[model samples]
Target: MSRPMNDPRFAPLNLALEEALSRGLGSGFALGVRTQGGERFQTCLGLAQRVPTPEGLTPKHRFDLASLTKVLLTTPAVLALAAAGKLDLDDPLATHLPDVYQYDPNHPVRRVTLRQCLTHTSGLPAVEPIYTWGEGKARLEALVLQKDWAFGESVYSDINFILLGIVIERLTGQSLAALAEEAGFAVTPGPSLAVATEACSWRGRMVKGEVHDENAFALGGIAGHAGLFGTLDAVLNRADALVFGAALPPAARAAMLEKQTDDRALGWQIRHLNWSGGGLSSARSVGHTGFTGTGVWADTERGITWALLGNRVHPTRHTDVRAHHQFRQRIGNLVQGIFAN
Candidate 1:
């Protein structure tokens, strides 16, 4: 049977959501929490669209997941390949794509390992205007392979995951979209639930029902780092399985969630001891935040997970930005309160 949905501990969560709406932190949001006992709490707010039209935001609306795409699509494929022994975490970037290394023998990127890429220690730049380069995947892959390595830095680079996504595609002969569906996500139809991010001068169109990230959009909306769309429920369902390893054997799940470096696992970000503003806290917690104001964190310690979907990029990406940090922290605090009682 499914878990019950009523719990007094969740009261603060509802209050938090109400407060966020009142403060204009978000036009709408979809939050879901599943406790260890399987109890569930879900709340939807505001409109998917700020304009009061027939097609404004609804409870079932979908928001751009942003960087969360890293764990949702890229990470899982990497794990599958690792489990099958088709890839090695310690293997150097040159081993997989040598052309990228030939550009500069001294390139620090050659020393980067798959594990480093997953853990955000690859020392690669966080982002690049790859879309403006007018190069195909092969050239982009080469460029990434030649990056300078900054080992031991907490630098998070989308290119690292983007390259990893390419590796997954080459190894499995499958697109990330195909893999995500196979892993159990139902893509939204007709862009109805999906939301727009920006009106790009380069793309010459208002980005909606398509990827908002320029790099991912250039890659055709199915890259390792970002670019995929779906309903809130679909994302949360997959996250539940990945964090708890409930869908896999106990040993396999443990291996996936096992801490490797300072609260990082194979593909998920583990909670750190000194996280400021409670950035996804909990011993067994794992989750990712998207640049589009979307985030999800699951606490294995409390058997609770929270998925917050918002379009802070809506209308304009340059609105009052202070709300983003506050929203994230409030969401974390609200989830922690759910387990306090």
Candidate 2:
């Protein structure tokens, strides 16, 4: 049989998670760890609320998954297309979505390439309130195309993935949401696993379970940047398939996981050196973080992965200070120790 969640090696991680929750780190959180050999350690804490419920936050509970949608849903499709020889990583944006550049005479969008988008070097604005436009997909696409695209410092930008999603849809003739499901994601209605994120200033309602990213929500809850949602197990299971080459061919998996740029694979954020989302235990790690107090990191070196899902944005998005970061690091450290033993 496998080890229990309370194994002494995991004590530090459990203690850290508990302490963080007690200190109001998040409304609730769930964590699951799987080793290379499939050894596992899982834990949950707090509640779906500050109070409690029968189905309180557990390892299976799905969280918003925030920006992780970029890597989880969007990037995978890009990789898949590349694997099929239908797309090129270095291909210019103008090749697929020529209109994005045509709409802007000042700064042509054609200059952007898939490689730049994946590496956050596309020079697109980090984010914009696209919901304010209240436009349809065509108009939204026009608005995005009209934006300037130039080289910039290394900073993550949602617009990169936003446009990337559009490219995927246009090339595959499939909606981002539909493609994710076909890629083996267990996406369900928002109210099922997800909790409400924000009662937005624009769309005045409690944005429950649906994607909390306004631009993505504006794009109809399935964008290359954010919208997809699923349980921790479901997401991890997908990761397992990628790592073990279940859905993708072995060569394709290698290509997907291969380091292309600094600390980044095709659709994954690499953890070889000490980047972010935790450290060395994060080495050999390829995972992503969500803005809404959620993250997933898998260390292929140790054959272990961890998923931390929480409604940190619940009630308010900015209330928590460093609790979530601390919690993630603590969890990473704890998981590392578990593998050490």
Q: In terms of TM-score, which candidate is strongest?
A: 2
Query: Per-residue lDDT of 101-174 in model 1, one digit per residue for the tens?
Result: 67686676766788888887777777888888665766655555554444545677887898898788888998
lDDT of 2: 0.72
Compose the digit string of candidate 2's lDDT tens values, residues 1-341: 33457766666777777787777767677777777777665667777654223235655556677787887778777878888888898898887877766755445468778988988877777888887776787787787776655555657888889888988998889888788777655343656555555556666666666777777777777678787677767667777777764667777778777887777887678875544456657456787788877788777777777777777776567766576776677677766766744
User: What residue pairs clash in candidate 2, if any at all?
Assistant: 35-303, 36-303
Off by over 4 Å in 2: 1-4, 51-55, 103-106, 149-151, 184-188, 272-274
Q: Estimate each model's TM-score.
A: 0.86, 0.89
Worst 10 residues of 2 by lDDT: 49-58
* Candidate whose lDDT is highest: 2
